[model samples]
Target: MFPPLCCDSGVDQASRRRHHQSRKMAMLSFWRDGLERQLAAVTAAMDTLQRQIDRDAQSDS
Candidate 1:
């Protein structure tokens, strides 16, 4: 689901751990960005609904 992580040419365990951590961090970042975007969209929608309700109530006066 993501581009490959940058990895060292060495085959030692530390290099492998670095590569794993890099990939994990990348995935987390991606997920966080997506969640934040969705939250913003929901918040905007709620604000719009509230405005419409308020406007309608005022018009009834």
Candidate 2:
């Protein structure tokens, strides 16, 4: 949850900026990790399909 915005509060703006930046970085890292996992799965599937295709071609020849 985001902190409530106040009109006359004394919260340090620098600290708020740093907090937001850290959250953004964390989100980027999480997405990057998820993308890497998806890429690996796709690569593995492609390799399997290639092998299957090769076997079928050899059998037909």
Candidate 3:
């Protein structure tokens, strides 16, 4: 009889899982940073538009 061949050992599987989780966390962190940057840009634009509107209203008065 022949012994069964396995793809990965227990240690190897655990290491791979840890590596996958780390990569996933890194990706999530990157996306979170990108979203935060976009939000900041949008907020700044809105503030600028509000200031302009206020100026225009004051001039009209």
Candidate 4:
């Protein structure tokens, strides 16, 4: 009975570790996706501003 209990404990610990790892991976993916989206938005805004600046300079010339 004692040996069986030890084996069971090991199995439970392994399963818990896997669960924690999966959760960490999920959170990392979520943050990464959010960062990518924000970066894309910033880049698009920059492009628009740059284009406007160019247009303004050309008009002045």
**Per-residue lDDT of 1-61 in model 1, one digit per residue for the tens?**
4434754466777777687788899999999999999999999999999999999999999
Clashing pairs in 2: none
Across residues 1-61, which tens digit of lDDT does each residue of candidate 4 receive? 0122234454677786676688889999999999999999999999999999999999999
Candidate 1 vs candidate 2: which has greater TM-score?
Answer: 1
lDDT tens string, model 3, 1-61? 2222545665577777677688889999999999999999999999999999999999999
Which candidate number has the best TM-score? 1
lDDT of 2 by residue, 1-61 (tens): 4654663356587877787789989999999999999999999999999999999999999
**Global fold similarity of model 3 (TM-score):** 0.77
Q: TM-score of the candidate numbered 1?
A: 0.78
Point out where model 2 deviates above 4 Å.
1-10
| Comparison by lDDT, 1 against 4, better one | 1
10 in model 2: Cα distance from truth in Å? 4.9
lDDT of each: 0.86, 0.86, 0.83, 0.81
Assess the local accuracy of residue 58 in candidate 2 as a C-alpha lDDT between 0 and 100.
100
The positional error of residue 2 in candidate 3, measured at the CA in angstroms, is: 32
Off by over 4 Å in 4: 1-11
Error of 2 at 43 (Å): 1.1
